[model samples]
Target: MRCAPSAGAALVLCAATAGLLSAQGSPAQPEPPRFASSDEVNLLAHGLLQLGHGLREHVEHTRGRLGSLERRLDACGAACAQASGTAAPPPAANPVVGDAAAPETLRNLQVQLKAQDTRIEQLFEKVAQQQRNLEKQQLKIENLQSQVRLLAPSHVEHKVIKPARGKRLPKVAQDGDTAHNASRLHRLPRHCQELFEEGERQSGLFQIQPQGSPPFLVNCEMASDGGWTVIQRRQDGSVDFNQPWEAYKAGFGDPQGEFWLGLEKVHSITGNHGGRLSVQLQDWEGNNESLQFPVHLGGEDTAYSLQLTAPVASKLGATAITPNGLSLPFSTWDQDHDLRGDKNCAKTLSGGWWFGTCSHSNLNGQYFHSIPRQRQQRKKGIFWKTWRGRYYPLQATTILIRPAVDASAS
Candidate 1:
């Protein structure tokens, strides 16, 4: 490559050496221009490939002159030997006064040669550095391509599926309807308490997506204190609560009226972030009472078991209530998860519940408009035994939950 400065250097070296050896006076040569910096050296490499031909011609002319001077010196020595039989005086001793600056000129030429060589080496180094940088950039691009290939399949598998407008959402099957509902999750609240905090004062139906669960519609009960998510209600005999395992597991009914929010959804809400459960009951005589408990409901593997702490608040007057059914797994007519061995509490009481040797409170029991005169028939009606006897059926009942307002939840 012309990157090497050898050609220009040969010209300078040849001219300088010839001037010194002949002990001859020559006109001072102009100094070659030097590179300002390494960057300029690179720019020159692109503009020009070879040193100037005029410089080469000048070096050849100097070499020829030096050869002529050598011949004349040889002839003069021969002539002196014949006349006085003595050798000619050494050329250095007979040096002309005009040749005094030959050594200095040679030194300057040598310095210029060395400088050009250094600039060429620097240019070579810069090229190598740029090549290394390009190689590193290529490696980075390859790594990113590999990552994209690894993640491509997952992107296709989990692609968000938007539901058709003006249609009810399909039932939770695989991923619990997460694929179709995920698009709306960002706009929907996670629970009724979140809605109340967002300044929703009116009680109505709203879509919610609990953590790890798909979005679904629920009725929000907006009270003065906060909002409550209504999970189950028995206002009228509109929706039957006497269902098997699958019906309760998948939930049934509407949010505007009486409905039971599915067991899986209740687990999603209460299991991840615990909640406070409130049971409100009204007797046929219009006597209303309520009870509150800090609760956590388990998942389907645990039969959606209920876990309740002591009642934090109760309006049962002086009634001594024992929360016996709090720790039991839920039971249904088909799949018995209750503790009772001989008879399924769900079959005996004609409804579903978390029952241990039967229940003290059976909210899912059959709705009775009036008090049953037969003692056996009363056990089939909705009853909270502490406030009212088992035979007295309730007029209306609501089961709601609000996120726990403790430090752990925060």
Candidate 2:
């Protein structure tokens, strides 16, 4: 093996190489940059400041809208409270008192109140949405401020700017939405529930029965599914009988809608007896109008439907003969009367009251004509003529259907 160079000789050679390299004069390396330039930092800060100002303006505008909605809501609440506090006038001592116009006035007032309530509810929803947007804008402004602080130069003094304050937003009306969803899962769809609520508020109380029969009170309530429920209540407020009726908004002019009453309830109350049923409506003007329809069982179950069309002048005069010898003007469309075989009772009629099968027949009148003309018939009473030649008074329930109206409008 070759011997290694001695330590003193290696050190002398390294020193000579360093001195030669220094004499050549190589350039020195520069240090890398750690921060952005002053101009770039200033530009970024300016952009952040503009965004912050825009957010502040938006927040102020939203607050103004929120305040307006709250004021409207307060007004609606006052109107609703006033409506509920007013009591209905007491009934006249006379059972046959007439107030035809009062009913209509009361109905209109109720409709207006309902409309106001609905408008308030819509405003509440809008306010809640605006509040959520305001929160998001605030958060954005905060983020922009943080970025500005990071980019700000050390020599430049930075001051924090606070957002303007406003009134606290009311809690959102989540209960209505939750209840609406829950109702759909169990009872009725959203549209139907609205119909039912409106109908309940608009229905009127009436006394209904067949000719010569004892009158029974029928309370009408609108179902959630846009149907009518007629119930007879006892003195203790318990229901005696109940009937379901379906109503559709059809026709034009005087008669605006139609109500369908099934034959099952008629059969239950009158049995094999046959006669005409009368519905007494007390108007706001203290005048009472009687709506009459023929109900003959004919030993079979058949459905009966009535049209809400204007009554013909010729038929109205003939049907206006009431038992009390008073002739009231017939304004409503009469029920369609049609006979199948020996079934002399009225079947379902289409279009106008006089447009059906019994148009030319002897029973073409508003009330049916039995074989014996001597039978006593009263327009305001419920009387049923049985096959055994005996007349019995009926106190039964009847369901009336009308077209579904908007809860707010109705």
Question: CA lDDT, every prediction?
Answer: 0.64, 0.32
Model 1, residue pairs in steric clash: none
On a 0 to 1 TM-score scale, where does candidate 2 land against the true structure? Answer: 0.18
lDDT of 2: 0.32
Q: Tens-digit lDDT track for model 1 on 1-410?
A: 13234544654554565467444333367556543443443443322222223333434454454456445444454333344433334445532222222443334434654564565445445444544554565566556654443332111112222232211232433465566555644444667787676566766665666766776767778899888988999988788889989889888875556788888877766655678888999998888998887777788888888765434313322123356424568899999987668888898897788765664678889987677789899888898877787667788999998877651244
What is the number of backbone collisions in each predicted candidate, taken in the order shown? 0, 28
Highest-lDDT candidate: 1
What lDDT does model 1 reach? Answer: 0.64
